[model samples]
Target: MVEFGSPVPEVVEALAAGFVSRELLDWGGVALRLTGVRAVDQPEFGSGRVRWRTATPVVMKGSGRDESGALGPRQAWLLPTEPEWPAYMQGNLRRKAETLGLDPGVELEAVNWIGPKRSFSVGNGLKPGAPVEVELSGPPETLRALWSWGLGQANSGGFGWVSA
Candidate 1:
């Protein structure tokens, strides 16, 4: 089932209200009629070790420092196999947690790609990724928010959608 979610309680409430009203969600030349509105309470993901599978690819990136010192993609997409994935995931989680006013203590323990790498055209370039099963550890609040939020970068762009 398609789901729209957020780590913030107010946003969740707003989404529920919109769904109840059968709102039309439109963005970037895409629109979906939000039907089958139901309030599903957040899953009870207790603290400690947890496993989450990405419904969408968990996206990451490497720094691109050109001769002019600009940031783009040194290497288009950062796959889970890359040596930099762990640190990037950690930092990304910290950023998300801090942004949501949650404690930034989530740790990335493991990630296993579950599907072939796929590419999608985004704006002027292509985004390469693959679905991943991730292992993580943190406090209950942080873990809940992580589940509510997602696994990696580009979550706002629909890339890191995950499930417990």
Candidate 2:
């Protein structure tokens, strides 16, 4: 079972079925906030399911020299495989911004349907759908948002990553 987070289907269906929010009895009494939904599938792994809820998944697809003058992956997203995945999604500020529709205007040049987390950062001409940007070092709000997004989209057959 996904420890720190709950299943995306349960959360989305609960909310869609007239439950705006629900408390995860398993996770030390933490609450989840959901926004929207999407459909996803992974045919290669023979693991096709519908991902229901969604987080405004964000990815950056450009490369430029920052003030630090360092080179890094041009395209990036809040991936599920990252060690910081849970913390990034479960922050307070991120949730607040998500609820407020504060999309940061960044876009992912490339995206993968069902592949390794690193595979999510490939391609070009991608765009974000009302995504919000929260700092990696944000507050509790940021983690909260990531949590909501992750669990809400985790096993969603109709959300997040899809396989075509």
> Which ranges of candidate 2 are over 4 A from the true structure?
1-15, 18-59, 63-135, 150-164
Error of 1 at 160 (Å): 1.0
Q: Say which candidate scores most in TM-score.
A: 1
Question: Against the correct fold, how does model 2 do in TM-score?
Answer: 0.23
Off by over 4 Å in 1: 23-34, 65-75
Clashes of 2: 32
lDDT of 2 by residue, 1-164 (tens): 12122224465555445533432333337554445334332122122112222333333223333437576656333444344444443442244446645432222222223233222322353332222322233233333333344422222321232112
* TM-score for all models, in order of appearance: 0.82, 0.23
Clashes of 1: 0
Q: Each prediction's Cα lDDT score?
A: 0.77, 0.33
lDDT by residue for model 1 (72-127), tens: 64554677776667788889988888888887887888775566687777778888
